[model samples]
Target: MLQVRLLGCFALEQSQRDQSAVLGRNGRRLAAYLFAYPNRSHRRDKLIDLFWTESAPDQGRTAFSTALWKIKRTIGASGRQMALHAVGQNVVLEIAKPAIVDAHRFASDIEVALSASCADSIRPAIELYSGAFLEEFDGDWVLEERERLEVLYVRALTLMMRQAANQSRYEDALCCARRILATDPMRESAQRATMLLYTLNGQRGQAIRQFERCRATLREECGVDPMPETRSLDLMIRSGAVFERIPTLLNETFGTGG
Candidate 1:
């Protein structure tokens, strides 16, 4: 079976053998786009527009055809199992059954987990997302898909973090909160959550330091102070009024205590 890992880097493996080197640069890009949206038909014209916008129509068509042909030649016999097909006015890349595409699988798993409101069930999907979707590529299409997947990833992380906190797994929840901040440092909610988690884990000093970091980040990045709620939480923590009610406080403040 062929596997395409387009999560962090581009990789192609067939029968446990690396085949990424066989496809040249253009072939790799063409294959990446097709496999990124497996089983869906992309209008040939649209594909041409996306890949060869600078060329004349005839020239673009030739380029698309040549690039696609090179991909097929690279696949050779595997083309029978996983092949590109012309369906009416569209081109479809058909992935063989049992083939793995990390991007597609991650999106599907995250969607199902979110739809079912089973945040804990998304761990597998979270594990699959090693990094940003196609971190090596940048195009309008790639950017759109990247952003969409990132939102889903962050949402899954948030849900899992809340679940962990509810279970009193402070360290795990803190890890997730840190990941969220890494993705978007401007996420005040995550910043606040991190601080609360640190305090809940018996690291009051660390929590206070976290607040300072948050304040500095907000001031440097947005030229603003932490939100009023954040400030109030900081004061409550410093006064030690909220220590005894950490669980209830987390629950009320961010739905983490459950």
Candidate 2:
């Protein structure tokens, strides 16, 4: 099996062989673009523009053709099996059988989890999403796909936090919230979840410190203050009122639904 890992550092892994002859940068990009949006045909001209826009028409076509050949050679049978081919000016990646694409699998698993409304079912999706989709690549297309996956990751963490909280798994919930904050420090909801979990664990001092950490992150990152809701939580922690409430609207705050 040839596994294309787009999450975290991008690497193409084959189950039974060395990947010494990896694709070139442009080859990798073409492979990633096709794998990221599998089973679709992309016009050769569009791919040329996307990846080799600065080149003259001939140079771009030459570069694209070279990159395509490199990709085919690097990925070999799996590439052929998946129909990673060009036909009459269109390129395609068609995987009729199973293939492990972390980006694609992450999105699919999340949809299933969301459909079931079961955060527990989402654990695999969260685990699959090790990092932003193709974090090493750059381009307009890469940025859009990266940001979209990042948002899904954050939302998945939100669901996990709420689930663990409901299950009284305070530590697990806090861990999920921290993971979310690590990726998106501006997420006040995650910060709040962290603070609440600390409080629930009888770590009031830690809860207050989390609030301070949140404030500092916002100040340094965005030159802004915490939202009013966050400030209120901070005040509640300071006044020893956090333990008095159950973090009301438990279902409302972290719900992934409408």
Candidate 3:
């Protein structure tokens, strides 16, 4: 079984072996392109265009062939057992193990955890999402996939924050909320969660600071003010009438204090 780790950096490992050989820079990029877009085979011309954009047509094709050969060699593919192979004029990465990609597993795990009843189920999924996809790689596909994975990570953090807040784990909740806000400053729900947790943790000033941050974010980004729910929370916090509340979209009643 072959495994490709794309979350932090690029690492290709065979199940039986302890590690993968060092792939050349172009070789790594070629392999990553195939892994990133796995559903369909890519035409030889397209692969050349994507990776060797600066070279002449013939030179680009040669460069792509070189990278593909290196990728195959690095993954231990041979004449009969080809990991990256040509199907007609198009090439495809036909690895034996479908679950060899960490990004795929991370996505599947998060999907399961989202609908799961047990909070514990989500822990592994959250842990699997170590960082942005292809953290060191810079390309159009890498940027898009990185954004997608980062969105997933943020959702996991939001869910953890809500779970912790429901369990009265104020500190943990605040930690998660802060993490979410750090990733996306315009995340109003996380801003509100941080404020509520700050008040509950006996730091009313910090709670106010969170609200101010939210207000500024909203004004700058959307050219709008905080919603009624946010203002209501503001009044409650300022007047020392703090209760167990959180950000919500539809209704004013997020939750009643227990």
Top candidate when judged by lDDT against the true structure: 1
Instruction: Evaluate all candidate structures by whole-model CA lDDT and list the values in order.
Output: 0.83, 0.80, 0.74
Task: Report lDDT (Cα) of residue 251, candidate 1.
Answer: 78
Q: Between which residue pairs do clashes occur in model 3? A: none
Better of 2 and 3 by TM-score: 2
Whichever of 1 and 2 has more lDDT, that candidate is: 1
Displacement of residue 40 (Cα, Å) in model 1 is 2.5
lDDT of 3 by residue, 209-235 (tens): 889889988998999998877787888
- Give the residue spans of candidate 2 off by over 4 A: 16-21, 247-258
lDDT (Cα) of model 1: 0.83
- Predicted candidate 1 versus true structure: per-residue lDDT over 73-188, tens digit per residue: 65665755688787678888887752378888898899999998797689888989888878888898888999899999999999888888888898999999998988888888
**What lDDT score is found at residue 189 in candidate 2?**
79
Better of 1 and 2 by TM-score: 2
Q: Rank all candidate structures by their lDDT, best first, as comma-separated numbers.
A: 1, 2, 3
Candidate 2: clashing pairs of residues: none
Off by over 4 Å in 1: 15-18, 21-26, 56-58, 76-81, 87-89, 96-99, 244-248, 254-258
